[model samples]
Target: MFVGHYAAAFALKGREKEASLGWLFIATQFVDILFFPFVVWGLETMEFVPGYTETNDFKMEFPFTHSLIGSILWAIAFGGIFFLLFGRKKTSGKSIAFVLGLGVLSHWVADLFVHTPDLPLLHGEPKFGFGLWHNKAATFALEALVLLLGLWYYLKRTVAKNKFGKFVSIGFVLFLLLVNYLNYYVLPANHDIIGLTISALVSYFLFAGLAFWVDTKRT
Candidate 1:
C-alpha cells in the first residue's frame, strides 16, 4: 500500500486540523513499524521469492502485526495514546481517539487492496487479500490515485504558514513516489530478512521525520 496509507491521515487531518500530520502518519504505519521489529526478532518472517508478485518479492508471514485482530488492537492502543497526548481544553478526547483509531485501522484496509493473501483475520484464522499486487498496472493506478488525491485535498484544506511548508510538502510526495518506485522496480532482491526489516523501519521513520518537518511549517 505504501503511501496510499497516508490518504487516510490526510483526509482525517482535513477534519481534525489540530492533530499533527506526523502523528497521523505514524498512526497509519504503526503496524508496519511493529512488523519490522518483529521480523528482526524472528517473531514474524518473510522470504524472497522472485516474481511471486508484481511489486513484492517476499512471502510474508506476519500474523502478529498484519492480522486484522492485531491491527484493531494496535488501533485501539494508538487511540488511547492519542487521547492522553492530545486531549485537553478545547480538544475532544473521544473525537481524537476515534479518528486516530480509524487512522490506524486504515492501514490494513489499504493493504488489502494490494497484498497477496498474506493478511490474517486472526492469529490462527484464514488469511485473505484481493491479490492486486499481481497486477502492476492496477496497483500503480490505485497507489498513485490515492496518494495524489490525498495530497491535493490536504494542500487545498491548509495554507502554508511558512515558505518552507510548500516546498517540504511537495518534496514529501515526490520522495514517497520515488521510494515506492525503487522498492517495486529498481532495488535488487534481498534474502537478508534482518536487513529488509531494518530498511523498512528506516524508510518509515524517514517519512515520519519529513512529516514532522512539513507539519512544523504548516498552520
Candidate 2:
C-alpha cells in the first residue's frame, strides 16, 4: 500500500476540474508520512517478522495513524485546512478536499487488502481484514493494477492538454514506480530501520516535489 495511495488522488483528476491533483496525491500518503517518523520515535510499532503470513514479512500495529476512525478524523482535519488554504466551499476545491480526504481513506482500503487482519474497524472490538497479503500474487497484482490503471486514467484525461504538465505527469508516475520497486523489493530485503526511514523520507520528497512542480506549471 505504499505508493498505491496516490492512485486514488490521480483518479480524482477525472472528476474535478479545479482540483490540485498534487495536493490530492499528498493527501493520500499523509498517514504513511506520519507513520514512518512515528515508527522511529516509538509512537508506532512494526517488525520484520517473516512467516506471519504466507507472503507478508512484517507485522505492524500502527493504530495511532492507520486506524479507520483515526484516518477519518485526520481526513476531515486536513480537508478543513485545505479549505482554509486553497479551497472555497462554493467552488470545486472544497469538493476536491473531500475527494482528497477520500484519497487519504483509500490508503486504509488498500491496506485492508494487504495487511494481516491488523487493521481496526474502529478504536476497538472485532478487527477486520481479508488477509489478502497471505495471497501474495493476488495482492501484488491488484496493487500494481491499481497503480498503473489509475495513472493511465490520469494520462488519458489530462496529459494532452498541456506540454509541461504532460511531462510532469509521466515523470511523476515513473518516479513513483521506481521508488515503489525499491521500497517493496529492494529495501524490504535490507531491513534496516534507518535505511527504511530514509527511504520513506525520499518518497515524501518525490510525492511533494513532483506535485509542486506540476502545480506550478499547470493552469
Among these predictions, the greatest lDDT belongs to 1
TM-score of each: 0.91, 0.84
- Candidate 1 regions exceeding 4 Å error are 86-90
Backbone clash count for every predicted candidate, in the order shown? 0, 0
Task: Compose the digit string of candidate 1's lDDT tens values, residues 46-144.
Answer: 777889987778688988889999899999998987787766444566777788898899999999989998899987658888999898778877887
Instruction: Name the TM-score of candidate 2.
Output: 0.84
Residue-level lDDT for 189 in candidate 1:
71
lDDT of 2 at 108: 84
lDDT of each residue in 70-105, candidate 2, tens digit only:
888888888888888878755676787888778778
Q: Score each candidate by Cα lDDT.
A: 0.83, 0.74
